[model samples]
Target: MTVTASDAHSAVQTLTQSSDTLFLLLGAIMVFLMHAGFAFLEVGTVRNKNQVNALVKILADFGVSAVAYFFIGYWVAYDVTFFADANTLSQGNGYELVKFFFLVTFAAAIPAIVSGGIAERARFYPIMLATFLTVALIYPLFEGMIWNGNFGLQAWFEAKYGAGFHDFAGSVVVHGVGGWIALIAVLFLGMRNGRVKAGKHTNFAPSNIPFLALGAWILSVGWFGFNVMSAQAVNGISGLVAMNSLMAMVGGILAALVAGKNDPGFIHNGPLAGLVAVCAGSDLMHPLGALFTGLVAGAMFVFVFTYLQNKTQIDDVLGVWPLHGLCGAWGGIAAGIFGSEALWGLGGVSLTVQVMGTLLGIVVAVAGAFIVYGALRLTIGLRLSEEEEYRGADLTVHRISSTSND
Candidate 1:
């Protein structure tokens, strides 16, 4: 055994590629599990009569999203397609495939977010169509502009503001877009039956606190992969991202506890708000800055959720707008503020650019949702019939329930 230098170099290259592939694959798996978190979160929040529908909606949407993203969405966003043969696709240890798997999970989150807002009163098939269209077209448009730098948007931001829009892990691209779109769907569908009767807001409390807590826990755990793995390669991983995520999670929890006054639902969703807010700046912020960002997000969720339900009567179950939409917007803006050298941050961002990008994201998301959902409302329809809603989606659509009548 003679060991050659060439052989050793070849071995190192293989190891590096393998490591990157495995890292992304694991990240994909972790994010994939977040769908279960979405399902359980919705299941626990909606009435038991709609539990099965919640579970079914998340899974079905994920499946449809995969198809849409694989066949069309990925191309629109990145000009990359998976149309080649398997052998050709297997190059680079199939890293591109795993990358698609990972990012598609993010894309699918649009429908998952909407499912919560329109729970208990949506038609399954119509929503599936919406999911397909959203993933294939609507979501990818923003994703491409933000993530892929499509149309020179990022370059334009940098030229105007001395820094490009910086969303490290898709605070605006994924969560914000999903939340705002969900808001449109909720508005278009109107409040659930009996949610507000005779101008009196009725309480539609969560059905299962334990399940809600479990869902939150899963999302919190999986978010590390969601954030850290955005690096998408082993060589780029950062301990800072992980630490920031932890600090933000705790900040959210404590703030929610204080703002929500120990309410179980708010307590559970608090960490999620924190995590959502931290995703954009996790790589660039100090742990303390991350903590502040999380605290703001938690308080925002509790207060805004209450306001929307009581005053606006939006009937957004699980408050996805506050938890994802508003907090995600905050994350995008806070990234530029907290990521500055003056704040002991990494110092490559501009606050002005952040605000512009965030506002643009809001406009794109809200407008896209309005167009798609409005068309659905006008044509194929969006909401269930009043009688069917009273019967519950599980019974009327799925013909099953969380509990056995027998």
Candidate 2:
């Protein structure tokens, strides 16, 4: 059999497509595992009585997010839908389907972040409703604006500031937005019962330090895939992203160790703070710049979390606002500063554009949280009853406890 030039070209194209498809599928699987990290993180932090609820919420939220994003969020963000026949959808080795899977994991993270803040007090079904609304509508709106360039916001930034906002991996888009929205839900839910007693915060130590550490470890391991695979194609992968992520993680660990006075919770969360900050600039930063970004984020999380717990009535359990919200914002700004040739980074990021884009993400997050959580609060209420709260969500919501012995 003689092979023609056209046949040869077609064969190469097919090979390339298949490779890219496999790469993206592996990345999506890695990200899916992060949901277990979320579950265990919440489970370890909340009281023992609420542990089961924490586990249940993360899995349920992911399920809900999958449905919402598949049906609505993907269309909103990319103007693509899965309504086509299987054969049509399976084109390109089903790369588009895996891309959606990878992205939906990110979408699901918003509700998981909120779950930590409002744990032990929030009703289950109402939280699910908020999860559906956020994934299907609110989150995808900003996601489209920044990632898909759907709303012309990126173009406006480029025209005005010399460069568009450059969040290579969504420091502001995913972590920042999720963190700020979690803040709104925390506020609406108020402090957990007996969290504060006459202006002094009560000590609610983690239920299981080992579980907390395990969760942190899982998230840290999976984050490599999260940042490195954002490129989404075999040709676009970079070892620089992996290196920067590593330096930032260490920087965060060391900084949190020093600043947090050797507290285990702070130590565990330090790497996450660094990872969140570095996501925006991992592809463009010098390792030193990434290290500094992580250092700042790690220290900032300790200080801000301590202040919010001690000085304010904001009962942000697990400190999502500090870890994700504020650090995520700093990451957006840091990308502009660090991702410049003058600063030993790859150039093409603008400080003005980064600031503007970060603020826009925060605004969208805050507004969306208010609209979703506020409506839930006013209509069906957002919290468990006083009796239910004392009993814990496990018994009240799930009809079980973390331990059978109880």
Q: List CA RMSD, all candidates.
A: 1.1, 0.9
Which runs in model 2 stand beyond 4 Å of their true positions? none
* Predictions in order: lDDT: 0.92, 0.92
Candidate 1 lDDT, 52-88, residue by residue in tens: 9999999999999999999999999999987789999
Report the lDDT tens digits of candidate 2 across residue range 9-63: 9999999999998888888888889889988888888899999999999999999
Least accurate 10 contiguous residues by lDDT in model 1: 397-406
Cα lDDT over the full model 1: 0.92
In terms of TM-score, how similar is model 1 to the real structure? 0.98
Instruction: Give stretches of model 1 more than 4 Å off.
Output: none
Q: Candidate 2: deviation at residue 376, Å?
A: 0.7
